[model samples]
Target chain A: MLSCEQATRLTSERQERSLTLRENTELKMHLFICSGCREFGRQMDALRSLIRRQPGDKPPED
Target chain B: MIPDSDIADLRRDMLAFARLQISDPHLAEDAVQEALAGALKNAAAFARKASLKTWVFAILRNKIADLLRSKYREPVTTTDPDCKHCAPADDQYFDDNGHWQQDTQPRSWGDTHWLADNADFWKVFDACLNDLPAEQARVFMMREFIELTGPEICATLELSSSNLHVLLHRARLRLRACLSGQWFGTEESA
Candidate 1:
């Protein structure tokens, strides 16, 4: 299993589309065994979805 | 004369780009207007260093920073009630026994659609972005939403590549943690 630090690093790098195949495989392996990191990945995906949904020029309502 | 259609198209594109950098919609509108005006006024000085889009974004970034600096002379507070339970000690939410607490029935990845239909999801998302330290937030916005390359971000922000990476990493980590808390009810683990 990957250490938390390694998993976190992979999580961040995943967003950049910069991870190698070997690195991605390793991250997936680690994620299978690490619930915390898996949860982290889910949250990251959720946040990405939310950010993408943000309207660029709509005013915030009072 | 520039056709009215072209002008409107430019305004729309600039507003979309500015929205990526500045999460606040009104601020994005203002930045887009200012950037469009600047680009027009300085049309003679287009030195071809980058694409027009990149150049326009650089202007928008500066304008957003100036607005943020003015509006937030004091640090913005980070007290959203929705995220109060996401503290580090709240790992119980993700613990083995507690995992089933919230409709724990596992669903296929494609089956989940809450974020798509829920407006509150974005409120929490924007709140998390706003929680980031100003500089970190700026770097994150420039790199991720605006899709600027690392070297470009470093050059634009006057930061070293390593510094830029570190800031981006921290910002992403924080956003991940914050969003997990708000969406998944999971506290950051170590």
Candidate 2:
């Protein structure tokens, strides 16, 4: 099993490029049992979307 | 038809984005203004398929690319500020065994879409982003915000693939920690 550090590293690398099959399988297995790594993965995705939003995009009205 | 308010908004946003990529305020302004003017001049030719903002951003990106090409033609040397081996603070997240440190374990950031649109959240986001080492922030923005391909960024920044990957990885790690500490996992909440 990949450690949290290695799993998280792969999560970030996934953003940059396609992971090999072995890497994909290992990361998926790690994420399945680790809520911390899963949350880390989600946060990374959130960060990407937040950064991609244009500066002009205003907050939705309450 | 593009409304006047929309143009104003796009101009402001474009300038902000350009300034993130280019250090010089004047140069960033110049690129944005030129892009706005070009977009206006060819407004009739704009296809309806893509959002107007996307089209204008493309023009601004082209201008920035040209500026970067001219400004950074010389291959980055070892002495370059970015090339300095500044050790990232991200190592604190993991233990010697490469597991997440007990105190630094990631927690759920509930309702991220809601946070994404929260203006206060964006302020925290910007602060977290700005706190990153300058080159890391710039390269991260280029890769994520500007949608530059990996090869494109390597060529433009004169960075090797490995170097670029490390910068990007560290940037993400730090940003996640900062955002969690400041917003999602605040002392009262976590």
Q: For this target, which candidate reaches the highest DockQ against the unseen true structure?
A: 2
Residue B50 lDDT (model 1): 31
Model 2 local distance difference test score: 0.76
> Residue-wise lDDT of candidate 2 within B1-190, one digit each (tens)?
6778878888888888898888789999999998788667767665442355666777787778777767745554433345453355477888988888877888877777666446688778779889889878888878886677777777777777767777888888888888888887632212
Model 2's CAPRI class? acceptable
Off by over 4 Å in 1: A53-62, B1-30, B34-112, B188-190
TM-score of chain B of each: 0.45, 0.69
DockQ values per model: 0.13, 0.32
> Which candidate has the top score in lDDT?
2
The fraction of reference interface contacts (C-alpha pairs within 8 A across chains A and B) present in each candidate is: 0.08, 0.51
Best by TM-score: 2
